[model samples]
Target: MKDSNFLKENNARHMWHPMAHPADSLANPPKIVVGGDGVSIRDIDGKEVLDAVGGLWNVNLGFSCEPIKQAIAAQLDALPYYSTFRGTSNDQVIELSWMLREFFEPDGLTRAFFTSGGSDSVETALRLARQYHKVRGESGRTKYLSLKKGYHGTHFGGASVNGNANFRTQYEPLLPGCFHIPAPYTYRNPFNETDPEKLAQLCATALEDEIAFQGAGTIAAFIMEPVLGAGGVIPPHASFMPMVREICDRNGILLIADEVITAFGRTGDWSGSRHWGVKPDMMSTAKAITNGYFPFGAVMLNDKIADVFEQDTSGRGAIGHGYTYSGHPVGAAAAIACLKETQRLDVAANAGARGAELFAGLNGLAEKHDLIGDVRGGHGLMCALELVSDRAAKTPIDKATIGKIYEATYEAGVMVRVSGPNIIMSPPLILTVEDVQKIVDALDAGFSAA
Candidate 1:
């Protein structure tokens, strides 16, 4: 490794980070992570801390997931690269599809469309949703509906469906016909509803209103995260998703569960849709699919989608979209190994247990510090603390204030992600009880310093 100053100079000179200003690189150089093991990571300066961000909400199995690492190396040695395109499918992908079908059998997902990552998965699902409608002779159903504060991805389709303006404003003139409804965010809402269940009902009604206003016949699908992730880890009421499912069913609109952050047991269940007891027409999964060992994703489809495409005599059913690395053998091998390890460890159970403890700790911190305006968690390892300048007015905390808390937290011995005014934590599911307490203590320290 190069010296700190050398590495820093080169990074600032060459690197352009995503979701950040290029100029910010020179002023506020990003932390250089040089090593990771177990659930901890060490920066270039050799400052080690418990990782609560979980590698961008992936890496559920932590850094020492040997099975996935070994599988990737073995597959690279056997077949470095093979594209599953145009009548040529790799053995690893084929086996992985079968495993995925069985694993998601409960969610009614019978088919798998592989992608390179979360963005690819979201793009694939959006395209498939429109195609599914077209296959059934409803090509007019091209519009998509989503929840406010929802995040899909960066692709045209995903970006259009994204409800957050941060990802959309700069990239204007995105794909047309994408609509959004109010999310069930109980903390602050236009409806001013504080009760979660009531807010969910109101939000569901907003969906119905949007369907009515847009004419459901023209809407192709509704995409949403079971627990809104990047827009902030906002978990809706227990009744929210099921209500959305029923509404979509009635409107004949496909529901695409964007499980990019909630799949493979991050939400205290095998999948978020399962946690809600509602099966979506299609599900976009990635991140933990390979435990972040490899860039991989899979969009799982139910029989309703599969039957339409399979039964179509016309070539309209033919998928017009795919990635060159759609079914890369290396990615497939890693996913297979990850699935085995994820199931063996039963990560959902650990996520549930640790998640509860973490949520409680955050709430306790809220009591101690006025900085924490809202504490959101409960489903699993995904959690967040929405900070504020004024608790009474709910004024968003300034950037420097949140940055202070972020730096203090890191200094106190935990690395968390700060987005806008929210401190998000999607730690590895393998977190120990002691690790959970440490995270809490670190945050306490962060707040005290702030």
Candidate 2:
């Protein structure tokens, strides 16, 4: 079985790759990553590469964290599988919920609904939003508002609400009534405004105007990523998030902060809401929650929604949504340990300090490289380098050029993600300033190749 072609043949015969054409996947045979320790991943060929994107931007504590592994193992030994359905709950689940509530601080959030991953978490949020509206006798409030270029998850509902066309092109005729408006992206400002605060106001005004045109009564919720992770890592415009909160309140609409990517210190804060001073009515979180140690996601509900269940409108009307893996004991244990390790290690602060260094490095690169059209990402550990065809015109580099740069970067031994012509970076929070310099150096080399 040591043959180089053995696993490739076996995989081609049996396994189907996600998000790829069959012919292309076979031709580019997937690199089998054998192991991960700290911020480094070892491929089957035994070559070591740094995990710049934290293994899909979920491994907040980096790879091979012993405490998380130990916690999962101990939970497996004690009670590997259990459900949080009906009235039954496990210690890990209960403790994790309380810990989350405490961490979030004196918010009105009263319950935590668990799911398998980010997509399911979005599904859960959509269902719960519908239920909450129904309980309040506002059943017609079925429409949702999300941001253009925003990515929630890949589920039917999530994808429908998400505004990225590339992800939803194949699945046309998605769920109806999901509308989109421009998010607070300063880099590609539609209004061409220089002031970040002014740009945010303009965007927020657009949202309010859209709500009015759509009739706020028909809209149940407005969802957005506080940091806009997938849409080229666009952080909110200055003081823009708080304005959204005000708009939602004025219109009696639920603000759902899809922190699935921004939660658990990705933004150098407990939640992106805290970073932006936006208190969302409902918050969906996952990814870094367990540091990718186990599959888990959660939606925290506010007291206003919780009150509906207390009135006893039906037979056991307790939110009335769940998944088979909801509140899995092992997942809960992993979350508990992961959260503990995050706090003990001060991961948020690490992200904050490291983010400053990363931003400076990228900014310097932007100044040096004409192909680098723009760079963005605030006080969080998120950054994106937009490649361009012309420096003075700020024109985006062509698709073919972007692909060439991406391939060149990969060949240069750095794994960076390409979203359109933008090379996005959300490296592991544990990265030191020196590690960030290395990533910048790799990007520089990739640029030179272009």
Candidate 3:
């Protein structure tokens, strides 16, 4: 039996991949990654490919960091798992919480609740937002508002709160009271302009209109990513977040910053809020927390909301929520290691520099490729290339053409991500200038072929 066929057969028999059709995967089997080191992954066929997406926008410290591996191993040897439920705790979990607080350092960030990953983290934030209002005697505030094209997570609450229609259409009847408004997408602004500040104010005005339409009293919180991640790598318009912050404050609504893909070093800052100069009442984070070495996520809350829980909860009710692995010791240990590495290596600084290089490189690609409609990115090792059949009208490539570009790029040995008709490049924070150039070259070649 052929070696490739043997592995493919095994996968066909039992494996089901996410975001992919089983039949399609079987016909063109998934690339079986066997190992990783630095910013590269090795397929089972021994082909080395640059990991441009950081394993779904995690892995900030990149493929194999000795410290993270050692930390996890040490934790496994000492205490593999421990629950943060019912008042029991572990040293790693406790320390990691404080560490995150230090990293964020925003006013009112006083508590941390851990989850296994991003979806759970989103759920945690959603629940906390609803409960905060309830505890404050504003139980009428049950509505959540997110931005257009935003992605929170895959859970029912998150899916409902999310504004991307494609992710929510098939699973309708999602949690009621979720709403959406226009995002600060300057490239394709509803009102056309290149001025970031003007675009920002316009977007904020749209949000205000939405709130007026729904009655702001019914809104619990407005959730968004400071720098859009999976949706399109779109950054917030200039001063957009500051204006949004004021809007939330004025309406007495919580601001939930979903930094699942932008936390840690991704955005050249510990949190995307800091990167964008916005202050969130609470933040949802995962992906980079453990640097993709382990699965972990967390909801960091400010003092304002934690105070509500402190008062008179003894008789009214328990908080009534927590995952079994809420604060897993192993995940905590890995996160601690990852944080230490981030500080020691200054990965955020690296990302700041690399992001500039990457953006310039992709923009350079735009000058060469007429198929490239737009290139968007900033200090986050994040980028998006919107493909277009007509540059002036900004008409997107047909789905078939996009699939061909995606497959061509993958076959050319660069693993990236695609959203809608746009290609996303989120190279890990550890990438070097040369690594970034390789990615740009591959994308250039792929676009040329497609």
Top candidate when judged by lDDT against the true structure: 1
Which tens-of-lDDT digit does each residue in 1-450 have in candidate 1? 789889877886786898898998778889999999999999998999999999899989999999999999999999989878887988899999999999999999999999999999999998888889998999899999998899998988899999889999999999999999999999989999999999999999999999999999999999999999998899999999999999999999999999999999999999999999999999999999999988999999999999999999999998888998999999999999999999999999999999999999999999999989999999899999999999999999999989999999999999999999999999999999999999999999999998
Model 1 alpha-carbon drift over 4 Å, by segment = none
Order candidates by lDDT, high to low. Answer: 1, 3, 2
Q: Write the per-residue lDDT of candidate 3 for residues 117-199, one digit (tens) a residue.
A: 99999999999898888777788999999999899988999999887888799899899988888888877877896787888
lDDT of 1 at 38: 95
Candidate 3: where are CA atoms >4 Å away?
1-3
lDDT of 3: 0.86
- The prediction achieving the highest TM-score against the true structure is 1
TM-score of 1: 0.99
Give the least accurate 10-residue stretch of model 2, judged by summed lDDT: 312-321
- RMSD of candidates 1 onward, in order: 0.8, 1.9, 1.9
lDDT of 2 by residue, 1-450 (tens): 466567757655567876666886677677777778888787777777777778888998889899999999999999989878987889999999998887765445667888999999898888888778877888899999999989989988999999899879899889999999877777686788867888888889999999999999999999998888888888876588889889999998998989899888888887888887767888898888899989998898887877786775664456667898999999999998999898899888899998888888889988887999888876678988888888778798997777777767666666777777788888888988778888888777778778
How well does candidate 2 score on lDDT at residue 126? 87
Instruction: Evaluate residue 324 in candidate 1 and report its C-alpha lDDT on the 0 to 100 scale.
Output: 88
lDDT of each: 0.94, 0.84, 0.86
Off by over 4 Å in 2: 1-3, 10-13, 106-108, 314-316, 411-413
